[model samples]
Each structure stands twice: as C-alpha cells, then as structure tokens.
Target chain A: MTVEVDVTIKPKRGVADPEGENTKKALHLLGFRNVRSVKSMKTFRIELELDAETTGDAEEEAVTSAVEEMCEKLLSNPVIHDYEILIVGRQIGN
Target chain B: MTVEVDVTIKPKRGVADPEGENTKKALHLLGFRNVRSVKSMKTFRIELELDAETTGDAEEEAVTSAVEEMCEKLLSNPVIHDYEILIVGRQIGN
Candidate 1:
C-alpha cells in the first residue's frame, strides 16, 4: 500500500512569532489595516510502501506511530507549537 | 468582494532549516530511514471587505499588492524563504 500525508506545524497562538510580527508591521506600513494575526504552517508529502498481508492493522499502526514519533521528534516543538495531519491517499484490501 | 488566501512559506532547498534538521535527527533516532528533506511552511486565511463599484480592478490590484507586500513584509524572508499563494474563493459581478 502507498500513502500520502500533509502536515502543518505552527507556533501556538499568543506565543510570539517574530516572523509573523515583522510581517504584521510591514502590512501596517503598506496600509493594510484590521489585520489580526499571522501564523505559519508546514506541509509534507510522504510516500510509503507496505506488503499485502501486513496492509490493514500494520499500516495504520506504523503510520500512527510514525506520525506521533515524528511530531515529538521533529515536526513540532511541544512547548510552543502545534501540528495537524491529513492523510491524503490510502488503499486497502488489495 | 470577498477572497480567501492560503499561503505557504519555506526555506529554499539546501538552506538549513534548524527546526527541520532537528526533526530529521529525531526521526533517524526513531528508526525511520531514507527520509529525504524536511521543510516548514505557513498558511494565512485573509478576509477583506470591498465595495461594489471598486470590485473589479481595485480588488485585483489591492490583493496583488497586499500579497506581494505581505510576502516581503511578513510572509517570507526574501533572503532564505520562498512562498506560494492560492486564492480559494472569489465572487465577482455581484
């Protein structure tokens, strides 16, 4: 089976985003008023291959584990950031 | 007129992404091999209110200017990052 995943990570609200803040200032200078907040996000496309017999539970477990592990390990900064994951493509029972 | 913009910003390839690099190292520790690259991106949802008579050209120019300004001002660091924009919804001739 093959799968594609899209992931986004952003600093939690109210936490200072230097990049976002600087951008806000620039927008104000450019005359865009009423601009509220600026947040950042990241997306990923991951492709994985697995065997037939191990398709169902194994695939799910593997992905779940990988995502969680990735989040904790590299995708997010637990203290200041949050992440969202979307599974784009999935195939089963083939 | 109303419009929705989804923007993504990331460091150019071969540029060092500290956050991405840390995550990559973590993934390696967790045993996911062959991982190629990790990049960070940000999305913005902007809603603007404009009048009827000024809808056509004004809206286009305003948005184009706003987007460019925003990218230079806040969305991306011109020296190291790149950005892409997608307009999600648009209503004209109302």
Candidate 2:
C-alpha cells in the first residue's frame, strides 16, 4: 500500500513574514490595493510505500503514525513552521 | 470583508517533474527507499479586502468570482500548471 500525505507549512501569525511582506508590497506597487495582505506557504505531497496491505484501520493508523514521525523528525522545522497533514491510501502507483 | 484564497499549483502528470525527482533522489541518498515518489507544490494564501459586509451569499459569491479572475489573469500560468482554489471570509484584520 502507498500512503500519500499533503503537508502545508506556514509561519504562524505575528511571525516575521518577509516573503509575504515583499509580495504585498509588489502588489501594491502594481495598483492591486485591495490586496490587503498575503501569506506564503510550502506544500509537500509525499508518497510512502509500505509492505503491509491496508486491510483494516490498524494498517492505516500505522502509516499515519509513521508519516507524523517523518514530519516531526525531517519534513518540518517545528520551531519555525506550523504544518498540517492530509493522508490518503491507494494502490501501488495510482 | 476579507477573503482568503489558497491556491495550489503543480505541473500535470507526464509533464516533467524535475523537483520531484531531485527530492526523491536526495531521500534515497538518505536511505528512504520506502518513499516511492514525491511531489512539490506551492500554496499561496491571498487576502482580499472588500468594503461590503458579508451578510448574504451574494457578497461571498462576488468575492470568490473576483478571486477566480485574479487567479486566471495573474496567479497561475495556464499553459504549464494546474491550480486549485479555496476561499474563505473573515473579519477586518483577524
């Protein structure tokens, strides 16, 4: 089974958003005044291949747990980014 | 009223996925072969300011339609990328 995870990472509110600020400034310069603000985000879609078939909730639970661990350990920087995860399972490559 | 739109853009399948390939190679170098594949996506959160209070469905519809126009005209490149849109309304600056 393969588990696909969509993780969106963004800077928390009140954090310094230089990229957002720069984009907003450019928009204002371009006369898009109603564009009050913007926030930039990075989204990663990861596919994890596992040996076990997802026959029950237990297998699904295990994959999600492993994905969460990957997030904490490598995918996201906990101090600077807040990440949201969406997971789904499918056959080998489709 | 303030409208928030989240857009996710990616190249269509069968079109090259260079970023995905690079990331996959790096992951393999780190011994994560269970990572069958990966895809990179960019998510932009845009905030639109409008004078009208979102009192009814009409106001909300107007904002989303306007946002869609922005997407078509400025945000995503039509030929090489596919985009998804999400819209929400919030109070003045919160």
Of the candidates shown, which would achieve the greatest TM-score relative to the real structure?
2
Binned by DockQ into CAPRI classes (incorrect, acceptable, medium, high), candidate 2 is medium
The TM-scores of chain A alone, one per candidate, are: 0.67, 0.75
Candidate 2: pairs in clash: none
User: How many clashes show up per model?
Assistant: 5, 0
10 residues in a row with least lDDT, candidate 2 chain B: B85-94
Best candidate (score: DockQ): 2
Candidate 2 lDDT, B1-94, residue by residue in tens: 7777777877776777887788778777766778888888778788887775554677667666766666566666777778877764466644
TM-scores of the models, in the order given:
0.61, 0.75
Give stretches of model 1 more than 4 Å off: A1-4, A13-19, A42-65, A87-94, B1-4, B13-22, B42-65, B77-80, B87-94
User: Candidate 1, overall lDDT?
Assistant: 0.64
Residue pairs with backbone overlap in model 1: A23-B74, A41-B41, A41-B42, A42-B41, A74-B23
lDDT of 1 by residue, A1-94 (tens): 5555657677787777777666656667777774544444556545444555555567677766777677777667899988777665765533
DockQ (Cα-based) per candidate?
A: 0.26, 0.63
